[model samples]
Target: MLSNTIGETKTARNFFGIHLSLSSDMLRFDIYKEDGEVFEDLAYRALKIAVMATKRKQIRNLPGYYKGVLRKLIDETYFKDMFMYFDVPLGDFYFPENYEPS
Candidate 1:
């Protein structure tokens, strides 16, 4: 799918980020995403889930803390907040798959 030209839609992916879908045989993606939108979405969902699953004490979203934490983990790896989200730290929350600590 190469036309040796710009705006060709050859791959549905560009510098700004993938913003299109593909044929059903190859794959399928129908979301317009920027660099860290996915991470932001996931982290927010994780924090929400964690806050919801908290039954002992009322968990508060302290902006000064949680915002920084979520920003720090945004682009490091996939499923980085799995432990925090699921409330099951397998002893490797700080170090997820192929993710180096900063």
Candidate 2:
């Protein structure tokens, strides 16, 4: 199964924020927002189960699940408003890129 490359730890201010460890065998995943034992592992477990089920069913698109999790964990309205600002045509703001898409 895929290992280290699939596992990632996000940190901020020298403190671990969230850890997303993915296992290839069954789409198993672990998310640790902080250190120590967790009393609420169900959320992570549920996500793992969903991912496993989706993979077994030959489903590829999982953005909806990601979006749902993000929306629920963050301020959806505020994030959407912030995202809209970034959706403007790039040509209106930045110069041409030095690198071209293959």
Candidate 3:
């Protein structure tokens, strides 16, 4: 019964004689429960489920676009920073990878 909204809007003017606008809305769920030592484990499982669900939906709706965007994010310099900040290894994300793809 968790609910939240994430939205972002971007606008660009005079980009090749076109006004570009991009906006997105994502509804996310956050689980609330008693705090304890196992909280981290529960939170991690919840996040794993959420990300898998979103990736499935995106691929179903726009496979090509999703793949391209995912590839770009994977290739970005700051991609590993996300996991590093949380002290989690990149291999822990979904399928484990022996080596990062270029």
Name the 10 consecutive residues with the lowest summed lDDT in model 3. Answer: 18-27
> CA lDDT of 38 in candidate 3?
39
TM-score of each: 0.26, 0.24, 0.23
Residue pairs clashing in model 1 are none
Off by over 4 Å in 1: 1-33, 49-61, 78-102
Worst 10 residues of 1 by lDDT: 15-24
lDDT at 68, model 2: 48
Candidate 2, overall lDDT? 0.38
What would the per-residue lDDT of candidate 3 be over residues 1-102, giving only the tens digit for each residue?
121211212111111111111101111213322322233333333334444667566534332343344334323522456545686666566855576667
- By lDDT, the best candidate is 1
Global lDDT of each candidate: 0.39, 0.38, 0.33
RMSD of each: 16.8, 13.1, 17.1
* Ordered list by TM-score, greatest first: 1, 2, 3
- Summarize candidate 2's per-residue lDDT along 1-102 as a digit string, tens digits: 112322433212111112232112112324323422231243344345545667677645443453344334334322347756776786677655785657
Q: Write the per-residue lDDT of candidate 1 for residues 1-100, one digit (tens) a residue.
A: 2223223453213311211111121123333234345654545543444444455556463332333444454424544665577866667457657887
Off by over 4 Å in 2: 1-40, 66-102
